[model samples]
Structures are given as structure tokens and as C-alpha cells.
Target: MTIAETAAGVEQRRRLVTAIPGPASQALMDRKAAAVAGGVGTTLPVFAVRAGGGIVVDADGNHLIDLGSGIAVTTVGNSAPRVVAAVQAQVADFTHTCFMITPYESYVAVAEALNRLTPGDHAKRTALFNSGAEAVENAVKIARSFTGRPAVVVFDHAYHGRTNLTMAMTAKNMPYKNGFGPFAPEVYRAPLSYPFRDGGLDGAEAARRAIELISVQVGATNLAAMVIEPIQGEGGFVEPAPGFLSTLAAWCRESGVVFVADEVQTGFARTGDLFACEHEGVVPDLIATAKGIAGGLPLSAVTGRAEIMDAPHVGGLGGTYGGNPLACVAALAAIETIEADGLVERARQIEQRMKSRLEDLARSDPRIGDVRGRGAMLAVELVVPGTTQPDAVLTRAVAAAAHRAGVIVLTCGTDGNVLRFLPPLSISDELIDDALDVLAETFRTTTVTS
Candidate 1:
């Protein structure tokens, strides 16, 4: 199907009738400043009226190429037909009955699907939640209950969530965690296998160092769980070196520490594989998933080994809207779309396209320090010429340029020096090439000096 036909039937081509964030969006921004809280930030002020395929139609009729995919949530596109139909049917039947109280069939179905789809062939169990943070918090609880331990281990550039405990687990400070402190205690941070910045340590050496630190500082016996993103998301799409994840999983197995894979941004065919952990054949003891789980609906889940998942008390694990009927149906539809549409393979195609273009760009731009990631989830880390010093300024400039030129790009990384690309799998090759053209021009015009 064509890109436009896929995304809500809007014309597939980018059309800029006015400047980015034209009059209508600017007026909305004014209203937002008056009504909305300041803490909640926006990447671009352009108000989205509609989105589908790979374009977000803004208030003033600007069709901007969507490379962010609403932060990797819309793997099947913003308005996948099946998800829309399922949500409509569920909404017509009922909106909320509080699954914790009444329960539902769709919820159970979602759990079953998650169990089957998540890595590993072993019998598994799943618990539903409203957000990635909630899933993570509950996963920690399950690990602690099962192991009788208090400490939770996370990596240096990890981003669990924004909740109290998850805030502690997350690594970044300014936006996500600054001043949000007195965060949950006993959350230990370990070194990650960041090849770009790890002083030339290979995957094995980095894993060895992390293991050594955890052994000395936190002691595996005291650790309840060691949570990591199979492919670190907000931390610049930093895919750990080869063997790092498997080695970590093996160590966790030996130590009885629950290996929790936070696949919030990398799951549901976004990372080529069904889950990022599958790339290394590492099956997590517990997997926290969200983002791409329910098309655009709010749903998250913790799927893991049966015994560990059952460790929580009968009543200790649920939320009022944990598995809202509407969200559950949406999740089921989204999963079906992924499987039926061959989105997993589509993600691989997107990766090859994006990596090829970015690598071509890198050959001429010294600031393009490294190009990394997998499937549709990819990134380029900017650096000072001839040095590994992060260049956040250049990153911001390029992102802003992309935005001005009617393309939506997102910036990430602990140092904020990386530009991430997460286009929808349903997006057409034509649209992707167009977005890359914008990126190429942005790089050409934006001065990057040594």
C-alpha cells in the first residue's frame, strides 16, 4: 500500500501550505502556554491534527514526515486499520469495568499473546499495567518477592521511567530526573557496554567490567534484579556490543538475579526481531513492554517466567485500569497487524535503508561520530571532529533544521548529542527517502566545525 493510503487516507506527499507551526498551531501554542503545565515539554510546537503512515498533518495543513513515530509507539502506523476497528468495537461494547474488579476476556487474550510473542519458548505468564514505568515497578516487586532481595541493578545510561522508583532506575538527569529525588533507594547503577564511549572496550571486556563492579559494590546475592534495555532507547539507541546481553543474562542466571529486559521502545517488531533481546538469543526472566504494544492506546505489560511472575501476592499485582478493555483489544489488533503484515521483516528493510543513507552521510561529515542501532530504530551520534567529545549543539541545530523543513526528528542520548530515527514500518520507501533528503540538507547547511 502507498504511504498516504496507509495513514488515514490523507495524501501521502508532504505539503507545507505555511511555515512549520503555522498560524493555527501558533494560536494553539498560545492557548497551551496558558492552560498546560510548563513541566511537560514538546519537541515541536506544531499541533498534530492527524497522523498516519509516516506523516503527521499539522494544524495549518503541513504534512511533516514523521521519523519519531511518536517515540516508537506506532510501529503499525498511527492509525492501523485493525487497531482502529478493534478499538471501535470495544469502545462500543464498553469502555471501563476496572479489570482489577471485573476482569475481561480481551485482557486475558493480551496476556496470552504477550506470553507467546516475547522471547523464549518456555511457558510464561504476563501481567498488565498502564505504562512502561508501572510495568517496570511491578517487575521489580516480582523479582524482590521471588528472590527475597532488596537491591535493583540498572545501567549507567538506562531509562526505566519517571515514577519514583523508576526515576531512580533511569540514568538521565535534566528532564527525566533532575530534582525528582529522594528516589527509591537500593537502586544501584552499573557500567554499560557503550562501545563509542567506553575507551575501546570490546563487548566481553565491558561485560566483565560490569560484572566485576556489580560483584564488588552490589553483590549479586543482594540484587533482586538487573534491568536493562536490550537496546538502550533514550540513551541514544546504544545497542550494547555483541555478546554483552547474553553474557549479562548468563551472569544473572548464575547469580539468581532476575534479568529484566525493558523492551518498551524496542518490542513489537520495531527492532526487526519481535523483541530486541532476540538478536542475541537472550531470554529475559521478566520483560517490561509498552510504547508499541497497543498501537497508540495506553497499555503496558510485564511478561516473564511463570514462577517468578506468580511470586507476587494474589492481590499485589493489579491496577484499576491495568488491562482496560479498549486498550487490550487495541493490543491484540496491533499484534495481529504486526504478524499479518510482516512488519518484523519490514523493520529490517527500514534499517537497511536508514543505515545506508546515514552511512553515506557519515563518509563526508566528521561530526557524524557513529551510526548505530537496528531495524527501524536507528541513530547517529554527533561528536567534535577528531575527538569523541559529544556535540549536543550540532545535534540540536540539525534537529531544529529538520523540524523547520517539515520533518519531525527526535534527539536523545545522555549527552543529548544523538539524533534518533524511528519511522513507522508501514511508511513507504518514498517517504523514508524524502525524510533522509531533508536530513541530508540539514547536515549540509548546518556548519559542523572541528
Candidate 2:
């Protein structure tokens, strides 16, 4: 199969003729407020009319620099030629024929790709789902079925999903879990090796602490799975200290606990490596992946050891829309694009550029507490000058200022003090530098009020 070329007609520069929202976007926002649910929040009220190659053109023709990559779902860029062509062909042929009932080649093709790409060379199996949350929930189900255990372990500052069980696994309270309970049961929370706030404990020591807590509180035998994000996403792009993941994986292996890597955010080429767990040479028993797995299509999967994945009954897994043919084709095209375009290397280049710029900015700004993340997925944690106290106010102010200046940035973390940068791997260096300039100016001006 041949790779598709970049889309035409969309310029790759930031341009703002009208205000940020302009009249058209404001009108859309007004319509959205009245028609859409109030809970569906938007990072920017500007309605996008066209987007490609690091620029999202709003209704009023304002071209905004897209740094968020639609929350890391567009690592291959929106309107990726390969993905668009694949989707177009698939839609023309067939959209869906539930994999559970009438399986198609594209579905098996995507599964084969995932089984080959994910960490480890072990005999593997895969199950498709429609979202990250569905993949995660199914992973948990598989783990429990294989281990015959009831308890599942999670960590603080983790963002799994909004599903009942995942929401229970998640640590944050507001937005994700507020008034959404009661959540699932038997999901235990453990301490993560957050180097920034671990008070001097290194990765190994932090792992020891977490293992002790799990052994004492949840008991190793009762644990069905130990799920964690190699690099925590929404929880501020927190990359665990060195040796943390390896140590934890080691203990889980020795204790027969299924170690599941929640790579929903860190999977694909979003991280420098195809999988973040590859950074530490830790191969998880099960890996939940989505967001960037299928360009921008709604698809997810649980790839794991053959025995574990096959533990559930024959008809126990699957959904009505899981592994939809169109999404499968999109995923195949996306994986091909990643390989043909050398996006893995591109992600590393993005990291180098982003880190260099953000680190330089941090040198002059004390509020830029820490710069952490891997590959194209990076972030800066905001804190009070000379102290570790989170400065969420400053973070919001800077993000808002960037939005006003025609840049799309996203803030995350339990404290809402992290400004994450998940630019598409296909984005150009020039656009990245342009967005950084806006960020620098925003920080310089907004820090005073913050």
C-alpha cells in the first residue's frame, strides 16, 4: 500500500484577521450553549471550519496554532491524506458489520498490527473497543477473569477514563468524578513515584513503598491487575522517576498480578517510543491503547498475552460498534502513516524543540516549576515562584492569553496547573516555534497579574 500525501489548500501559518472567537465562532458558541449540553466544555469557544498541519481555521478565517492535537488524538494530523483516503474508501464500501457477528479483514488487520507493534514479543491477542475507557474496562475484565481476583490497583493522579470502573480507578475528584458516583468497587489506589513531590525518595524507593502499601492493604493474591500510565496524562504529564515502572512490573510479575499499561494517552508515536513502557524496557502483560491509534477515528483496543486475553468467555467481549470497519481502515492507515512518514523520529524532534524552548523559558520564569514528558507529548507545571505550591491561576491566565493570541493550548493535572503540549507529529518546526513565541509572550505579560 502507498502512503497518502499531505492535504492541500490549508496554509501552515497562524493568522487572526478577526478576534479570537470572531462573530462566526461566537454565534456558533451561542448556538452550542443553547443546543448542546452544558457539561460539554470547550477549551476554546472558536468553532473550527478547517484544520490541517498544526493550524485550525475557525469560522471567521482566523488560523490558530494547534498545540493540543485535539488532546493527542491527531498525532498524524487532522486530514492526514492516508487516513482520509482510507476512511473515504471504507465509507464507500461499508461502514460497519459488527466484528462480533460478521468480522472483516480490516478488523483482523488492525488487531494484527497492534499485536505486532505493542511491547513484548510474547504470543499476544487483541480485542477491539470503541474508546479508551472501553478498552481499559475490558482489560480489567480480562485480568480479573484470568486471575480470579476481585481487586484492581491504580495510582494517585491517574486519569483512566470516565466509565464507572475507570472513574473509580481515576484519582481526581472534580470534573471527572464529581457527583458522578457511586463508582465501581474494589479498585484500590496506590502511591505513584512522582519525583517532583516524592520528598527525596528515588524511583526504586518509591516503588518499594507502593508495593508495601498494596501488599498490606489490597494483598497481592487478591489483586487482579495493577494498571498505570507509564507517563500520567491529564494528571500533569507526570513521568514516573527512573526505575519506577520496571520495579513495579517486576513485582507484579513475581506476584502473578497482571501489569496493564494504560497507554491510551502515551501510545502510538505520541511518546518518542511507540509505547511509553518501552522507555524503561518494561513490557506490560496488557496494554490499553486509543487516541492516535486510528488517526482521529473513535477506536481503541486491549492487546495482551494470549492466555490472558482468551480467558473471558467466547461471547463475553465486544460491543455493537466495536471494531467498526471504517475505524479499522483508519487505524491501519494511521499505523502505516506512522511507519512510512517516520513519525516516531518526528516526535523526538518535536520533543527536542519543545523542551529546548520551554526549558529556556523556565530559566527566566520561576513559576515554570517543571518541564516533563516524552516525545511530542510534553508539559510545564506551573507553581509559585521559589516554592512548589501549584499556581493554577497563572496556568489558566497563560492558556487564556495564548488562546486570545490565536494559539490552542490545553491545561491539565489534578490541580489544573499543567499546560500540556501534544502537537501532531506531522507539525512543522516553524509552526512549533511560532506557538512557542506566543506562549513566551503570554507568560511574560500574564505572570504579573497571576
Candidate 3:
């Protein structure tokens, strides 16, 4: 509301003193082109020098309202006071002795917190990792070890990660999996219950269809796990119809298949619930989480049934920097901040507020084909007015215009027509209101390019 420590007392508000990609940012981009790999594409070319609360200060000192939240990693807000303090204290004490070599209290504390917070009350154990992909890969390993199965199933419009095994689990082919294959083996795909495009199919029918396909195709007897994003992230924020997840979980339980929920994007109060699986009351055998776990620090975990997690031989899982002391402390502080701020309820309020505005926008504009998602994670699909034909050209144009106007927005969907909004819970309604206003105006002025 006032000033932020991240920017050395920079006021928390969107103030564009120069063009969005001010000269300084363009300079950095040029430098990046020569120094950094071409594969590392940028959504917003403007480089952020400082960020906190809902604002990202670019190199030219322009304050931009942050809607992306570093791709849902800063759910507790950027450089949050508690997280910063904890990391600072932890760093001064010791950076890392290697958890596997010499375990620390913070890592144990974080595991305890995740065990208590994740969906089920059933006896659970947690193992930390450095990224979402690692968490997912480990979950699969544990599941396979426990079940002695080789096959795994993932759904359409799903994004697991970019690792070799995760790439096999992921559905999209373009940026995530193009030319990078020879992906891992024994990964199968299934149909997802997409409400917007599924001919009004209900959750139960969708689940049945998917279950039958898995039965016929990747027989349950051979399947180790069914990994899914409770709400699909990069493949578009597709919330599979209500009963769909529950039915799948039940089938997995009966079939001796581990149900793995990849909550990388939807965890840590980003959705109204602490974990999106809670919304469906579906308990997963294992849940892989990363984004939003440690403010901006790289930390991920796979928490699940104790017996299954313990199935793998000792030393089968772990990394040198798996649970660095700094990251562990930051995670603890972030969890503390979320509970203290009542961020789960705040995320619900954000969902109501954002959906209200998005619905209003859709009413007047036929291009807005649908508005869906939960908590602070909302999205709008741009379409060709009368039909559900994706209008990707228009989508890209509008997002670029928003960035030019000092408002950050992201686009997803397999078709690239969905605009996702994941603002930090610490963001004020006023910032959201202003950003939406910019989006509305951008939509009004942006002409369909194709």
C-alpha cells in the first residue's frame, strides 16, 4: 500500500515514466540476444530490476503492475518481508551443507508443514526437490517403484514440465517438446473433460470416457501413475469438469494406480483452496509441487502416502541442492505469510472480483469466448465472435498492447488464444481494476490481425 523494500522504498503503484520497453530495457534485450541462448524467449522484454507486492520496476525505473507473479511462483508476493528476512538470516548462518549429507531443521520443518497442509490427512511423507519437473519425475519413480508398473498416463491439455520424463508427460509439442525428444518411454495420453469444447459433456461422462480409454489403451494393470494438473496450466487453465477428477481418483484407487496431482501452478493458495485437489475433495496418492512454494526461491516437493514414498530404496531420491537452507527458510516464511494473511480466502475474493469484470467484458465482446479458472488464477479465451474458433492473432495482439501500456498479461491454451491472469494475493483490488481497464481498452483498440 505504501513503499516496498524491494525497490528501496519505491511506492507500490504502476507508474510508467517511459515507454514500456524503455531504452534501458531494449539495451538489455539486445545484450541478451548476443549473450543468452536464443531458446530463452521472453514474454515481456522489459527487464525487472526490482519487484514486490504487485509492482515490477523495470531498468528505466518504470513501475509496472505485475499480473504474472513470475509465472505463479511469487504467490506470497515478491521479496515479501518475511521471506526476505528468513532467507537473509539463514544465509548469514549457513547457505548449505547438503541436506543428504547433513540434514537441517528448516528442511524438516518445511516437510512437516507440507505434510500437514496438502490434501489428505492420511499418513504422509515429503521429499524436496529443486524444481517442479524434478518433483514430478520423483513422484513417477516412487509410484513405479511402489506398484512395479511401467506405464503412466497423462491427459490432453496438460503441462508437467520440460525435463525428459516430464516432456513425455506433457501434451503440448511446440515450445515445450519440439525437437527435444526422444522423450522418456511408457507415457500415455488420455482425453480431458474440457467444458468449453466438449459439447456440454458433464464431469462423470468425461471421466468415464477418459477411464475407458486408459483401460483399453494403457491398461491399469501396467500403469504406475496418472499425473495431472488439478487445473491445467501451460496447456490453458482448463479445470476438468467437477466430478471428473473425483471419478479418476476413484478409478486409480481401485486399479492400484497411483493418482499423482501436479500442483505446481495451482498450489499455495493460488487457487482459493491451498491445493486445487481440495476443491474436488479428491485425495491424491502423491502431489508434486513447486511454484509458489518459496516466494521466488527454487524449491519443490513430492508429498504423498508414507508407505509408497518409502517404497523406493534409500538414496534413490535426492540432490545436492534439493533443500538448500536458504530455500527452506524462505518456504517456511512464505507458508507463514500465507496463513497469517488468510491468503486462501483472499484468493477466493480475487476469483470473485476478477471473474465479475471478465464476465462483464465477455458480455459486450463476442471475441471473449469464455472466462474460466479459480481463485486468482483466471483466464479468457479469445474466439471468432459467433463460433469457438480460436483467434490467436487477436490474443497475441492484445497481450502485446497490455505490456506496452505497463500491464503484464500471459497467453496460453494449446491454440494460444487463452489469456491467463495470476496476480499475487498481495496485489490490491485497485491494481487489478486498473490492469483490467487497460485490458478492456486494449481489446477495444486492437484489430484482429488475421
Candidate 4:
């Protein structure tokens, strides 16, 4: 199919051959080991030769269903014709002319799109960056500059990013924060409304408790921003209870603290809306976005109240390739695809299908302690029967078995017991069913470890 002719529905029917990594991918891995950095640790060994919509064709001709969406990056599907064409066209014309030096229309268009798509209609502005971490770092800088405060607050079990500042904000210690110490100071961790694990405290109560703790420890007056992920990503797919986000938003407004919603993993229609905060009717002061923003390109953005975004001195926030022409073009195409194609509603559809399937599995199997998340971003939390103890062994086994059966599955959570599904909203109903069957079969024979 030409770049212009491939449709989402037509693209999901592709099939797989040879196993995921077959000979071609193995050879590629060997070559990669020789040339690439040793820090790369892929969940699967497949070498993608071609991809479109919800399917990935490996070098060995195996077409595996993509349930992870490239770590939730390709929400519009891989190789979307419009995005591909836009990127190709932009690259041919001009690759780099740093926006800080000479601005471009594509960059402004992207920022405008973000301003409109994000919550709060009262005079919004946006700044683009190269990655989720960069967007997050800038959000903090803007908050600090605007509020003139020294401290920032994040929540427990949060996963912001890997950079020095973000690592300080990030709650996970292992892997992300280990050894990369001497983190930025004055970052505090507060409690979150994780109903599944934290007992005795509901949504509002949890928020109140968090606010009280912050007041006692950091003092809200000294806090510049309180960064949170509406749907906790790397801390596991833990969705805050109904009133947690709303309560926090109100608190931030009352205290003059900038509320930054780190929607890097849950924005751009991934969570059934352009941003997950919309689910709670909470309009954050600043919203940081990245993963799914550009349909697979490296693009991140921070959109917020005009006053707060402009607080930083002129030339205070930018990057050489922050809004690279190619990425900006891809974002425009991706946003167009999301709206024109109704990917938001499509995400809801995927959620309903997966929820129904997984709920049934949970009911039948005592191992599935909880199944949660909204829209296309959903997960199943594994636990010992009749208890809250995490069952990482069964979780690992189920994911491995699914891979063996030709479906890619990803695991997350501090305990490594949650299987998150980030399948493209454009994924077919049949493909969803097939992947579910593989999961069901995987659970049937897997043994649980305490």
C-alpha cells in the first residue's frame, strides 16, 4: 500500500510468521550488541521490518499484535500514512533551523494544537521540548520561576523521568533512581490515593492527608508545584480515585501552587480523552505531555495558563531540536488523525472490550486481584488468591507465555505484578480477541509464586 492508501481498518489484518525473534531478528540483535549501547534491554527480541496500525511485522515475517504501543508512543498506530507523509515532506524541505534562532509555522501550530486540546480555555500557551523528561523539567522550572518557591512536591509510587531533576521527583528508587544520586534538592514525596493498596483512606481523604503532610513538611507556601500523573504510569497503572485529582487541583488553586499534570503517558486520547485530567474535570495549571503526542516521534510539550507559562524569562525555555520540523509535522498529523478519526472514542471502545474480557478472566481466576485503568490504557494486577500480596511469578509467566504465543505483553508496578495493555486504539476487535485468548490460555497453566 502507498503511504496515502493504507486505512486503519485494512491495516489490522496483517499476520505473523516464524516466531517473534526468528533468525533475522537474532542476527539483528547480534549486530545491535556489537554497535548499540549496552543499556538497551528490550522486552522482546523482534526486529520490526514493517508496521502499520496495530500490527508489527518482524524481520523474520512474524506479525505480532502490539499490545504495548511502543511503550504507549504509537497511539495513532505505526506508520500512519498522513504522519509518514508529513515527516517525509518536512525532512526533504529543511531538517533544522533551531526555533530559538528562526521560528517556524509547524512549531507554533503544534503549540496551538496543544493549547486548544489541553484543559483551561482562559489564555493558554505552550512550550515544546524533545522528550517527556525535558517537558517535565521545564514544567518544574516554569513553576519555580512563577511561584518563586524552592520546593516541589510529587507523590509516592510516581514515575516522572530519568533526568537528574526528574529523578529527584520520581519515587521509584531501583533502576530509575539508583546510583544516579545527588538529585536536585527540595523535592518531596507525598501520598497518593491508590485505593487498591492503601487502606482506610478513600480519594478525598487521601488528598487531604497528602496536603496535610506537605503542609507540615514542605509548607505549601514554599512549594512551587505539585507534579502528578493522573494515571500513574511506571509506578504501575494505578488510577487515582474519583475525587483525588479534583481535590488537589482545588488545593493548588487556593494555595497559588502550580498544578502540573504529567500526562506524558496518558495524553493525546490514550485515556479516552485528550488528557486524563479531563476525566475529573480538573484543569491543571500546567500539563506536560510527550509519549503519544507525535504518533511515534520525539516530541514533548507543556501547555498551561498563559501567565505561568510566560513567567520564565524570555529565551528561558527552548531546545535546538525541541520542536524539530519533522516532529512538529508528525504531531500535526497525529492530532489531525486523533480528531478526524475519533481515536478518543476508539480508545474508549478498546477499553470497554478489554475490560469486559479481563473482568471475565478475573472473575474466573483468583489470581487476578484487580483489573483497572481507563480507555486503551488498562492493566490487570496479579495477586495471591484472597489476599493483596503481589504474585510476580504468575505475572511473569503469563507475559512470557503470551509472547511465546505470538502476542507481546508488558509488565509494570513496583512489585512487578501488573500487566498493562497499551494496544493502539486502531487495533481491530478481532486482534483484541486474539490477544485476550492468548492471555487467557497463558493464565490457565501458569503457576503462582508467593
How large is the C-alpha RMSD of every model relative to the true structure? 1.1, 2.4, 1.4, 2.4
Over the stretch 1-450, how does candidate 2's per-residue lDDT look in tens digits?
Answer: 111223435788888999878999999999999999999999998998888888888999998888998899999989899999999998998887788888899999998999999999999999999999999999999999999999999999999999999999999998999999998999999999987788888899999999999999999999999999999999889999999999999999999999999999999999899999999899999999999999889999999999999999989999999999989999999999999999999999999999999999999998998999999999999998888889888889899999999999999999999999999887888889989999999988985434
Across 235-268, the per-residue lDDT of candidate 3 in tens digits comes to 9999888899999999999999999999999999
TM-score of each: 0.98, 0.98, 0.98, 0.96
- Candidate 4 per-residue C-alpha lDDT over 1-450 given as tens digits, one digit per residue, 9 for 90 to 100: 232233443445435567656988999999999999987677888787677766777788777788999999999988887898899999999998999999899999998888888997789999999999999999999999999998999998899999999999988787788888999999999998988887857789899999999999999889999999999998889998889999998999999999999999999999998899999799999999998999899999999999999999998999889999899999999999999999999999999989999999999999899999999999999999999999888888889878877887899998889999999877778788888988888888887577
Ranking, lDDT, top scorer first:
3, 1, 2, 4
lDDT of each: 0.92, 0.92, 0.93, 0.89
Q: Top model by lDDT, which number?
A: 3
Q: Number of backbone collisions per candidate, in order?
A: 1, 0, 0, 2
The residue-by-residue lDDT of candidate 1 on 23-108, one tens digit each, is: 99999999999999999889998999898888899999999988999999998999889999999988989999998888889999
Model 1 ranges with Cα > 4 A deviation:
1-6, 448-450
Better of 1 and 4 by lDDT: 1
